[model samples]
Structures are given as C-alpha cells and as structure tokens.
Target chain A: MKMHNFNSGPSILPQEVLNQAAEAVLNFNNIGLSLLEIGHRTSWFQDVLDESRSLIKELMQLGEEHEALYLHGGATTQFMQVPMNLLDDGETAAYCDNGIWGSKAIKEAKLFGNVNVVASSKDKNHTYINKGFEIPATSKYLHYTTNNTVEGTQWHALPETNVPLVADMSSDIFSRNMPFAKHSLIYAGAQKNMGAAGVTLVVVKKDVLGKIKRAIPPIMDYRIHIENGSLLNTPPVFAVYVSLLTLRWIKKEGGLAEMEKRAKERAEYLYNALDSLPLFVPTVNKEDRSFMNAVFVMQRPELEQPFLDECKKNGMVGVKGHRSVGGLRVSMYNAMPMDSVKAFVELMTEFNNKNL
Target chain B: MKMHNFNSGPSILPQEVLNQAAEAVLNFNNIGLSLLEIGHRTSWFQDVLDESRSLIKELMQLGEEHEALYLHGGATTQFMQVPMNLLDDGETAAYCDNGIWGSKAIKEAKLFGNVNVVASSKDKNHTYINKGFEIPATSKYLHYTTNNTVEGTQWHALPETNVPLVADMSSDIFSRNMPFAKHSLIYAGAQKNMGAAGVTLVVVKKDVLGKIKRAIPPIMDYRIHIENGSLLNTPPVFAVYVSLLTLRWIKKEGGLAEMEKRAKERAEYLYNALDSLPLFVPTVNKEDRSFMNAVFVMQRPELEQPFLDECKKNGMVGVKGHRSVGGLRVSMYNAMPMDSVKAFVELMTEFNNKNL
Candidate 1:
C-alpha cells in the first residue's frame, strides 16, 4: 500500500530526494565511500556543504548580505544561541509567542536577556496569532515562529516590526517564498519542510554576529561555525547530504512558488473536506489556518477512533495530532503530494458520512 | 571496487547495518510509513527509543546503578555540561590533558569551574601519555579522554583517582569493554564506534547530578535530560536508531570481549606491517599505541605520495593522517574487517619494497 506520511517532522521528502540520498549514502559523489563515513574536510563532503548552503541562499533569494550556516543542535539549541549571540546581557529582545515553539524560544532567550512579549496568543490558547501588540523600539530583535506545527497556525505575512526580525521557520520553511529581507536572521530545523531532523539551517546577516558581550561556548557561537564553514567539528554529514538532495528536488520541482501552490491546493482540499463535513470541526481560526498542518477535531468524540482507523485503513499515517492539542493534524509539508491530500480528504468524507 | 574506510569517525559501519537503516528510512519496523516521517510519540518510535537505550545498558553491562542518556550537541557540549552539573562555580575539577580532545574538555570545564591540570602529555607534543601524575584529592571529579583520535593513543589503564572520574570515550566507545564503574560519568560522540555524528551517549552514575551552584540551561543540564528520559527535546532519532543497529551487531558478533580481541588482532597486524617496513615509522609510543587508530609517518618524506597513491589504488580510503600529525593513520575501528587490514598491510609491504 502507498503510505501518505503526515507526521509533523522527519516528515515527507520527495521520492527523488530519498533515492539520491540513499545512493549517496551507498557511494557519495562516485567516491566509493558512504556519505556517512566520508571525512567532513574532504572535497566530496565540502561540495555537499557548499551546495546545501548555496541552495538555501538561492531558495530564499538572499544575496551576499546573508550567510547561511548548517549548524547542529536543532531549533531548540538556536532558542538560546540566538540571544547569546545577538543580545547583550542586560538588553531586551522582543518575542511574539504565538505557540509552543515561540514560547520555548522566549524561555531560552530569557536565560541570556530580558524578553519583551510583544504579542502572545496564549490567552486564547494559541489558536490564533495576536496581531495588535506593539513592538518596543528599544528591543534588539523580534523573534517569532513562522508556523506552529503543534497548534496548526501559520503567519501568512511577516510581523511589522522596526527591530531586526528573527524568524524560526522550523515547520513552514520552503513551503512558500517570503520577503527574506524583512528578517535579519532566519532558522529552521530541516526535519519539517527541508530534509532530516538533526541539523538546523540558519541564515544570518553577516553584520549581526559578534555583537553580544557574552563568552558564548564555541559550539554556540555562530561566528565560529561560519568562519570554519560549519566544519569546525565533524558535522551531521548524512543529514546535510539528505538536505542537499531535498534542495535539488525542490529546484527540479520549480522552486518555492510551485511548492506553495501545490501546498495550498493540498491544504485547501483537506480544510474544505473538514468544513463541509458535519463530523469534524477545524481547530484553528479560519483566517490563521496553516497550509503546512491542518488541525481538526471530531464533532462526536466517539467517532474519533473510527475516523482515525478509516484513515489508517486508507494508508494515511501520522494523522494523529500533537498530544497537547488532542485531535487530528494532517501535516501537509512541501513534499506531501496533492494526491495524498486528496486521498486523506476522500477517507475523511467517507468516515464522516458513515458516522453522521 | 570495495573501499576500506579508515576515517577515525563518521567511520565505517557494517554493510548489513547500512542496508537495515536505509530500509527503516523507507518503512520502519514493517510500518508502511517512512521512519523519517513517523511521530516520535507513536509507539513505533518509542519502541525504537526504548530498545536502543536498553541495548546500550546491556552492551555496557551497566546495572541498575547507572543510567544512560542520549543527547545532542556531541561530546563537546558535555565538556561544559559535566562541570556545570557536578562542580560549583568556585570548585576545582582535575583533568588529564593527553591530547586535543582532553585539552578541549579542560577549556570548556574552565568556563564553569576552575580546572586543575593533574597531568599533560603536551610537553612531548602529545606523543606519549604521562604515566606520573597526582590527582587532586580535593577536586570534584577527574576527567580524561579514553582514546585520543587525533594523536592515536589510548589509555591502557585508567588513572586511580580518589575523586569521581569522567571519561570522554568518543573515539573508542563500544570497541571494547572498560571499567564502567570506575567513572562517575562517561560521554561519547556516537559517530566513531557507535553510530552517526549528531547524538552523544552519556552514561552517568545516578548520584552525580544536581550539585552545582549555577543555573544550567535546560538542554545543558544533564539531570533534566536524565529525569525526562532524554526526551527533554526531540532527539536525533535516526542517529539513535543507527546506534541501536550497531549495538545489536556487536551483541550478535559476540560481546565486547570478542570485540576487544578482534581489535587488538587488527591493530597488531597493521602495526607489525608499519614497523617491519623501512619506509614507514609508527608515530605514537609503542606502549601507548591505539588499537582503534594506528598513526604512522613515512621514514623519508619523498616516499609519502607514491605510498599513499598505491594504497588508494588498493581501495583503502581515509588512511591519510590528520593535518596536526602529518603522516598516515589507519583507523582500525570495530567495523573494519581483518582482511581489509591485511590488504592495507600488503600495500604497505609493496610500497616499502619499492621505496627501499
């Protein structure tokens, strides 16, 4: 049976990417060495490093002004590293806490400096983005998550802020093209829309680094990684290789514009199915619904199991929502095909008819 | 041509392990979904986590007294984390700086507490371990790297310390059995002998945590990860899975005792080949020669290129030594077959005859 993957992260990747990644792991760049075992310093691996970084720059359409670094420790590590590198000890950074990831970032940032919660959707259980709050002029930077994977809310537009913007696009990166110049720094863990789970991609304005006064640990220092070309130590080689493959796939599939169109079509189909059905209710506010993840609850609680079972029988996987949200979440990442979404929607309609 | 991989880390893995890992990435544990796209909270992933952790405990022969935690940020992060969790700001920790990794650990340790260098092999350009050194009885813990990957040295026996001992066994972990009980903490980056590059394996005595005066970051706090079952954040899921496969392979091929015997045999074969040849000279002290990585250099500089080319033609890869030590290093890690070692030895003999 053909499986439609809908897990939040370590999510779906294009088949071409997977095949290329597998081939490289078997024999990298025709080097007769597994990508897993090649020395990070070798020209073969360096090509991977350079190409992966270049692809991100190309995808974002960022020029020499932005530097892309493939760093370890995932997005969670960046939560602390961002403030440690950008904010002085007593300075303040603005954070828009739209969901769990945003709140976590704020928490880590507070370890290094004072965090001004410019806006928070926590009062409304993070079901929508709060747009009315003011950004402080004194803030060093403003941090926000582009998409909340758990809650299924996405920022369709950039937040208006005079301060330098830092976006954690972990769940929605590459799903669409955005105004890259609005953000001074953007980071994303590759598992969601990129490739694997271990590596975090960061695009920082080269001028913004080395401003903080703290003696940041070498691993936590962006300057160190960038200077060494992200090969200061042995990198997550396999993850980076897979990410490169995914990037190539994205380019072959007509880049982010086409990706956004396909993503929207998939998400709209699923959302429309939920809206028209009597047995399900969409969780997020209509205006704030995520194209990356569609969250919905069963109208009748008892029908939840049968609906999930029917989806599974139809070869849909990872439809179960995050434990915090307790419903169904269809993570339609960039690599998730329109056919998979149509299949899922068909299953949902069938289950709704039976249950209703 | 079959390539013999001798890269110190991101080293070679068993062919079967690679095949199995690739299969899992496509469809994990018979689930029709790609392992990459599976939800970690699902029973399927949880089972992988539990079994992987369990295998580590079993392979190490670690009893109920010890706890294992799989973490991110590699062993480098543990350098700071060890002191942050165990020593107060003003307290001192004893460190044995035998090579690069040990000195790095000492450097990171100084960030959290005062470090007393009990012994250092640096006086001899890190070519030999200092047999004579006194551990400070007043120090919080004694730290050392069990194997120096760069210098190609290994501790034949651990130093007897009154204080708690910590070992950075990144390069030699799981290659052989050692005194697990002798140390309060043992941390290893998983790339070398264990699995991939992103995950770090930490085995800490249960009683050693939560004594520091400083507020450690949640991710940096060893106790927090331990208490949370290393699920403090989403882990390097695929890396852990690969480690589990390697562990299973080790168990199936007879335990660590057999592994030690095989490693010794392989190292001896390669070392004998280098020693007997007039063209090559071993780099490390004979008594301290590493069983995992055998470092050597050409007796005459001009013979280096031809010898390296001949070895490359024989399908040996990554035998070129580290830049710090300009020579050749044949890292005979656990997965290296004795036949490959013999093949390398043959190449060495042919090159030696030509050079002489």
Candidate 2:
C-alpha cells in the first residue's frame, strides 16, 4: 500500500528535499561531515543560515524594513515571547479566539498585558474565523491565526486595521501569496509548508519593536535576533538546513503561486467529495474552508469506523481527527501532491458506497 | 586530509549515529515516511519518545521520583524557563556567575526573583570556579553551570549546598555519570554528547516543582511538562530521535564510565603536549581544566597566524579560540575519537619543530 502521510506539522516534505536533507546528514555539501556534525558557525552551516533567511525575504518579497529570524522553540514559545517583547503592562492587544492555538495564545498574552477578545469562534465549535468584531486603535497589535490546523478554517483575507498586525501562519505559511506589507510581524513554525519541527520563522517589521518599556529577555527579544542575525545561540541547525532545502524545492516548483494553485486544487477535490459523498459531510463553513486541512465527519456516525478502517487499509496515515474535534482531518499541505488527494477522495467514495 | 572537528557544539556526532539518523530522515522505522514527516503523537514516534526518556532515566539510574522531558528549544531557553518555573517573586535563588551562560541565566533568574550571586569566576576571566562562597539558607535553589564552555573549565565536584541544586549541564551531559538524587533538576541542550541542536533534556525531581506561588506560564512550567509527558505541544522529533540514536551509541560504546575514561585519556594526551610543546601555554588554571574543552594560547603572539595556518593545512577545524577569549580551544567531546586528538598533537609537534 502506498502511504499517504497527513501528519500535521512534523508532516510531509518534498521528496527531493528529503533526499537532499538525508544526503546532507550523511555528508553536508560534500565536506565529508554529517550536517549534524558541523557547527552552525562553520562556513558550510553559515551558508545554510544565510540562504534560509534570504529565501524567506525573497519568497515574501520583503524589504530592508523587514528582518527574518530562524528561531528554535516552535510556535508555542512564540505565543508568549511575542507578547513578552511587544506588550507592556497596562497595554492592550486584541486577538481572535478561533481555535485551540488561538485560545492558548490569548492566555499567554494576558499574562503580559490586557488581551481583548475582539472576535471568537467558541460559540460555533471553532468552525469559522470570527471576523465580526472591531480592532481597537489603542491595541498595540491585532493577532490572528491565518490558518487553524485543528479546525480547518483559514482567513482568506486579513482584517483591514490601523493597528499593527501579527499573524501566526503556522499551518499555512508559504502555501499561498502573503500580503507581506500589511502585517507588522508574520511568524510560523517550520513544519507545514516549510520543513521539519523545532524551528520558527519570525518575519518582523523593524519599527514596530522597542516601543514597549519592558526589558525583553535577550533570548526572546526580536530586536536582539534582528541585531544578531538569529545566531542568538546554536540554532536548530538540522531543522533550518531542512527548511532551506524545502525553500529550494518551493522555488524550483514555481514558488508560492504554484503552491497556492496546487493546494486549492487538492482542497477543492477533497472538499467537493466530502459534500457530495453519501455518508460524509464537510464540517466547516464553505466560505472559510482551509486549503491546508479539510476536516469532515460521517453524516451517519456509524460509518466513521468503516471510513477509518478503509483509510488504514489503503495506507492513509494521520487522517485521524484531533480529539478536540473528533471525526476526520486530511491535511493537504504544500508538499501534498494532487495525486494523494485524489487517492484520498477515492478511498472516501469507496467507503461511502459500501456503508451507505 | 581527513578533517578534525572540534566545534563546541552543533559539533561532532557519532558517525554511526549520523548514518542511522540520515537513513531515518528518508524512511523512519520502515514506515515509508521521513522521520521528519511523522506526527509526534503517532505510535511510531511515541515509541521513539518513550525510548528516549527511558534511556536517559536508565543511564542516569533515575527512578519514578524523577521524570525526564525531551523539549523543543535550546539550553538558552532553559536559562529563563528554569527560574520561571522554580523561583517565585521575591523568593531568592543562589547562582554562580561562572561564565557567559551562567551570567545570562543569572540575569534571567533575577527577572523572576531575587538571585544571590553566591560565587563567581569573573575576577579571573572565568578561568576558575569560585568555590569558597556559601549558598544562603533562605535561597530556594542553587544553580550552577557544570562546564564553562567559553573558558574551558569544569566543576569536577558539584558544590555541596543545603539549597536545592539545579545544574545546566549543556556541554558535558551524557558524557559522564550524574548524581541522580543529589540535584533537584538537571537540564542539557542535546547538541553536545547527545544529538543535534534544538532539543533540551530536562530531568527534574517530580517533587521539586509546584512549590512556587506564581503562576508559571504553561509552556515554561516543569510540572505541566511532567504531567503531559513533554507533549504539551509539538516536540522537535528529528532532534529527539537523533538523541535516542546517540544514546544507543553511548550504551554500545560502554556508557558514561567509558565516556569519562575516554575524556580523561584525550585531555591528558592534549594537556601533556600543551605543556611539553614549545610556543604554546595552557590558558586556564590547571586545577580547573575541563576534560571536554582545552584552551591554550601561543607563548609568542607573532606565531599565532603561522600556528593557525599549519593547523588548517592539517585539516583542524573549529580549533581557533572564541573571540571573547583570544586563544585556541580544542573541544574534545565524547564523539571525538582519540585518533583525532593524536593527529592534532602530531600537527602541533611538527609545527613547533619547524617554527619554534
């Protein structure tokens, strides 16, 4: 059986990237040393660092005002560090509580300053992005999740706000064209549409920082990272190297425009199947449907087991839904080929035909 | 010429471990997916996580009273998070300002609570550990760096303090035996003597946490990590897997005792040559020398460039001194072979005969 991997985050990467990364691990750039063995300070690894940072700027078309930092600790750490560096005591920031990560980020933000729940999807089982509320002019920044990995919802268009924007594009970064100029900061954990876990990419507009009065911990300070060029400490070298290889793959495959096209095609095919199939139904609002993850459930709840069994029989892995939103979720990241999505739809169709 | 890697970290890894890790990057545990692709929650990776945690406990002889967590982020993150979880506001903790990392940790700890600098090596440019100072009885914990990476000094014996002891063992962990019950907590970045960069090994006595009154951020909370088995969020899977492979290598090569023996053997060989060879002098106090990193300076400043050139010609990399300490440093990590050190000594001997 041909396995179709859909493990969110620590998920699929381009085959070429995998092969190249594997080779580097054995002998980095033919230096007769494993990439794992080389120090980040070495010329071989410095090239990787410089290249990874530069590629992000090129892909997003970011300018001199923006600096890209490849940091360790994943996006989870960023939830706190972002506010720690940006939000001062008695200051206010607004956030949308649309999903698990969003709610968690809101919690961390409150620890630093007053965080306004400007919008929320909690009333609707987190199936939609809450866009009904207003962003306060006094808010230091308005934070939003560009894509919710668990809820299968994405903000196709960001809110037009005067307040500085900070977006966590963890699950959908590099999968589509980003309005790089609109946001003050865009951060992502390098797992979806990037590389492996352990690294976070924080692209920040330089001017938005240093206004807060708090003395930020040097490790967590974005300004220090911009000053030090993200070599604050020995970074997640293997993860960053893998990310660089992934960026190379993305550029080779026609960059974010092509990625967006493929992602849309995959989601459309899978989402259409979910709606039309006898025993299956799409879970989220169609307008807010995510290109990264398509979550659905069996209309006839009894068929859920058969659907899962059929998926397993076909070697479809990680299609299992998050425990919070139980049913099914198929992550179609940038690296997920159209053929894999087609195979997934076929499995769903066959399972529905037998069970319905 | 075969290269000799002595980079402090993100440094040399076991060759067999490197080969295995590289193979895993392509296909993990025969599951047709890259280790980079698998979800940390899946049984495949759950096994890796369980095995990694178990190996640490087994090697350290830790029992149920202690729990080991494999976390994302490097040791620098640990500098702040350690105090965030351990020290409450106004509660004092004792720390030794022994080196750069130590000074950094002290700075972060002070942000969370009152930090007493009970001892320091700064007066001597961090070449020696100040042993005469006493830990305050009211201090919640006593923290120290096990090795001064910048200055090439090691604490051969941990300070016997009535206060709870916590160690930052980033550079020397897994290379020798640890006093499992003597410390309240032990943490290490996995880049040295373990694996690649990005993962942190936090071994904590279960009871030591939760004593503080302040609400520690969930991500920074040691108790939460213990409760969730360090899966509070996505972990650095590749780094952790590599760590497991390295641990396996360590066990195969006779574990900590063998590592300690090899380290002694390498240090003795290099230190002997440093003393006997012309135009070279050891920089640090002989009593405080680190078995892992040896720092030495040219007796004659004019010979520095010629010596460095000779080293490069013989394929010695990362032997140049840190800019902060303008002297050569040879990091003889556990993965470093005795043969490499022998080769380095030969290069030194020949260079001295030709120049000095």
Candidate 3:
C-alpha cells in the first residue's frame, strides 16, 4: 500500500530523491564504491558540497555577503552555537517564546549570555504568533522560530527588526518565498523541508560574526566553519548529497513560488474541511496556522482513537500528534501530494458523518 | 571493474551492509516509506537505536557503568566535547601528541582547561607511538588518539594512569579487543571500522561525568545524551540505521574477535610485502605501525605518480596519502577483504618490477 506519510520531521522527500539516494548507496555514479565509503575531501563529494552550497544561495537569491553551510549536528546544536558565536557574556539577545523550539533556543542562549524574551504566545498555548513586540536596540540579535512544529503556528511575515535577525526556519524553509536576505542568520534542520536528519543548513551574513568578546570553540564558531567552507571537519556526506538532490528537485519544480502555491492549496483544503466538520476543531488561530503541519482535535474526545484507527486502516500514517501534546497533527511538507490531503479530508468527512 | 577501496575515514563497509542500507532507503521494513522520511521517534527507529546501543556494550563487554550513545557530528566534535565535559577551567588534563588527530585534540582541549603534554612523537614525524609518558595523578583525565590514521602509528597498549582515560578510537575501534572497562570514555566516528560518516559512537562511563563545574550545553553534555538514550534531539537517522546494519554484520561474522583476526591478517600481508619490495619504504616503526592504515612511500619519489596511475588503471582507488603529508596510505579497516590486500600486494610487485 502506498500510504500517505505525515510524519512531523524526517518527513516526506520527493520520490525521485529517494530513488537516487538508494542508487547512490549501491554504486555511486557507477564508480563501484558505496556512497558511504567515499572520503569527504574527494572531488566527487566536494562537487556535492559545492553544488549544495550554490543551490542553497541561488534558491534563496542571496548574494556573496551571505554563505550557506551544510553542517553536522541538527538545529539543536545551533541553539548553543548561535549564542556562543554572536552573543558574548553580559551581552543581551532578544528571543520570542512561541513554543517548544523557541523556548529551548532561549534556554540555551541564556547559558551563554543574557536573553530577554521580547514576545511570547505561551499564555495562549502558543496558538498564535506574537506581534508588535518591542525589539531592544541593545540586543545583539533578535531570535525566533519562524514555524512552531508542535504548536502549529507560523510567522507569515518576517518580524520587522534591525537587531540582526536570527530565525530558526526549520519546518518552513524552502517551502515558501520569503525575504531570506533580511535575516543575518537563518538555520534549518534538513529533516523537515530540506533533506534528511543528519545535516543542517545555515545561511549567515559574514559581517555579524567576530564581534563577540568571548573565545568560541572552533567547532562552535560560525566564522571558522565559513572560513573552512563547512569542511572544517568531515560533514554528513550522504545527508548533504540528498539535500542537493532535493535542492535540484525544488529548482526543477519552479522554486519557492511553486512550493508556496502547493502549500496554500493543501492547507486551505484541510482547513476548509475542518471548519465544516462539526466533530472536529482545528487548534491555533486560523490566521496564524501553519501551512506545513495542521493540528486538530475531536469534539467528542473518545472518538479520537477510533478516528486515528480508521485513518490507519485507510492507509494513513504519522497523523498522530506530538507526544508532548497529543491530538492529531498532519504534516504536509513540500513533497506531500494534494491527493493525500484530499484523501485525508474525505476520510475525515466520512468519519465525522458516521460518528454524528 | 570493482575498485579496491582504501579511502581513509568514510572507508569501505561490508557489501551486504550496503545492499541492506540501500533497500531500507527505498522501503524501510516494508513500511511503505523511505527510511529518510520517517520520524526519529518512531518505534521503527527507536528499535535501531536500542539494538545499536546494546551491540556496542555487548561487543565492548562493558558493564552497567558505561552507556553507549550514537551522536551527530564526527570525532572532531568530541575533541572539544571531551574536554568541555571532563575538565574544568584551570584544571589540568594530560594528552599525548602522536599525530594529526591527537594534535587536533590537544589544540581543542587547551581552550577548555590547562593541558599537560606528556608525550610527543613530533621529532620523528609521528612514525612511532610514544610509550612511558608520565601522566599527572592530579590531572582530570589522560587523553590520547589510539590510532593515528595519517601517521600510521597505533597504541598497542593502554597508558598506565590513575586518572580517567579518554581514547579517540576513530580509526581502530571495534577492530581489536581492548580493556574496554578501563577507559572512562571511548568515542569513534562511524566512518572507518564502525559504519558510515555522519554519526559518532560515544561510550562513556557514567561516573566520570557531572563532576565538572562549568555549565555545559545540553547538546555537548554526555550525561544529557545518555539520559535521553541518545534521543536528545533528532539524530542522524539514516547514519544510525547504517551503523546498526554494520553492527549486525559484525556480530553475524563473529564479533570483534573475528574482526581483529582479519585485520591482523590483512595488515601483516601488506606490511610484509612493503618490507620485501626494494623500491618501497614503509614509513612507521615496525612495532608501532598501525594495523588499520599502513603508510609507505616509493624509494624513488618520482615513480610515485606513475605507480598511483598504474594502480588506478588496474582497478585500485584511494591509495593516495593524506594531503598534509604526501605519501601513500593503504587503509585496511574491518570490512577490507584479504583478497583486496593480496591483489594490492601483487600490483605493488608488478609496479616495482616495471619501475626498477
């Protein structure tokens, strides 16, 4: 059965990318060596890194002042690295406590320097994006999670700030067109919209670094990584290659414009269906809802498990919500087909009608 | 033609492991989704992490005191993480400077604490591992690289020390039977003898951690990783899965005892052939020579390029040495076949005859 995959992260990748990745593992470019066996410094893998970095910049339409790096350790590592490199001890950085990822980033930043949470939606269970927050001019940077995967909220507009914006666009990067160059630093874990779980994509403006007074560890320092071209050490080669394939796919499919179109189509259909169905209630403010992940609950809480079981029987998987707060979360990444969204809606309609 | 792989880290893995890895990427366990598309928290992936951890402890024959963690970033990350977790500010730690990896380790450790350079083989270009290095009793830990991949020297015996032992076994881990319980922590990048390139295997004794006074980042802290069972954040899912497959292959083929046996056989054959060939010169001391990577150079340096060209024409690849030091290095990890060694020796003989 060709099931509809809705896993939050390590989520859906284009079918062609998966095919090429599998073939590369067996015989990389017919060189008779597994992709896993090749050295990172070799020309073959270097081409991969080069193309990936180039594609990232080209897609974002960023210039030479900004650099793209495919680094090991996920976005969680960046949570600390961002502070260590840009914010020195006694310096303050502004953060928005939107949800889990935002809160975690603030916590890690606090360890390295003073963090002032300028805005928070915590009082509302992070169901909506906090706007009109005052940005402190003394802050070295203003940090926020552009998309909250758990809370099912996304910032549709870039937060207006001149404090050198740093955004964790882990769940929404490359899925829609945005003012990418406006931010000084943008990082996203590859598993969600970019590629796989091992590699992280970081685009940073070179001028923002090296101003901190603290001595940063070489591995944790962004300037050192950029100087070495993200090859300061052995990177996740397979992950980067997969990401390159994905970047190529995005280019072929007409770039971010096409991706955003598909995202809107999917989100509108699901949201429209949820609004019509009396048995279901969509979580989060409608305007602040995420285009990638849709979180919802049943009016009759007892029907939740049965509805999930039915969805499973009908070839739906990974529709279950996050364990931290469970209801139902249907993640529709860039690769998710509209047909799957339609099928899920049909299933929801049938279940709601039968239950009512 | 099937090339004989000798690339230094990100080296060859078993043929069967590659096949299985490729298959999983297409359809993991017939789950109708690519392994790259599933969430790391899924039971499917949790099982992989669990088995890999169990296999690591079982192979090392360690007790409950030690915990095995599969982490992101390679051994280079550990160079600083080891010191950050173990050594406090102004505290002294003993380190041996044998070759590239050890020297890098020493450089990173200096940022975290006072480092005591107990032994160095720099006078001889790291051709031999230093023995009888005086480890300070008051030091927080004694750190060393067990195998110098670039210099082709390996420590056959553990250093005698009362301080906790931290070993970077990135090149030689799982290829030999060591006193595993004696070391406070053992970390290896899974590119050589373990599995692939992205994930690192960290086996740490629980007792040595949490004693340091500095505030450690959650991602860099060993205790946090172990407590979360290496699921502190989304790990390199595909990398860990490949490692699990490789670990299973190792166990199925008779564990570390059999791996060591094969390694010794392959090393001895290549080393003996190098010793006999009048045109070739083995670089390292006979006793300190690494069983994993054998570095050598042509007596007539000009013939080196011709020999390498001949090797390439005859289905040999990655025989080139490290870029830092220009000489040939043949890396024979656990998965390297005895047949490859025999063929390489035969080629060396043919090249010597032609050149002489």
Predictions in order: lDDT? 0.85, 0.88, 0.92
Candidate 2 lDDT over B177-240, as tens digits, reads 8686688999999888989888999999988888888876788888888888889888888899
TM for every model, in the order presented, reads 0.98, 0.98, 0.99
Q: Considering DockQ, which of the candidate structures 1 and 3 is the better prediction for this target?
A: 3
Candidate 3 docks at the CAPRI level of high
DockQ metric for all predictions: 0.65, 0.76, 0.88
Specify the highest-DockQ model's number: 3
Best by lDDT: 3
- For candidate 1, the lDDT comes to 0.85
Residue lDDT tens for model 1, A1-356: 88888888778888777777667756677877777787788888889889989999999999998989988788988887899899998999999998889988998888888999989888888889877679988999999998999999999878887889999999999889999866889999888878888888999998888777788778778888888888877788888888888888888889999999998888888888889998889989998999998888988888888778887787888888888879888898888888888888778777777768
Report how far off residue A341 is in candidate 3 (Å). Answer: 0.4
Per-candidate RMSD, Å: 1.4, 1.3, 0.8
lDDT of 2 by residue, A169-221 (tens): 99999999979778899899988888998899999999999988887777889
The true-versus-predicted C-alpha distance at residue A214 of model 3, in Å, is 0.9
Tens digit of per-residue lDDT, candidate 3, span A1-356? 77998889989999999999999999998888889999999889998999889999999999999999888889999999899989988999999999999999999999989999999998988899988889988889999999999989999988878789999999999999999999999999999879888999999999998998888778888888988999999898889989999999999999999999999999999999999999999989989999999999899999999999998898898899999878999999999999999999999999999998
Candidate 3, residue A226: how far the Cα is off, in Å: 1.2
Clashing pairs in 1: A10-B36
Worst 10 residues of 1 chain B by lDDT: B32-41
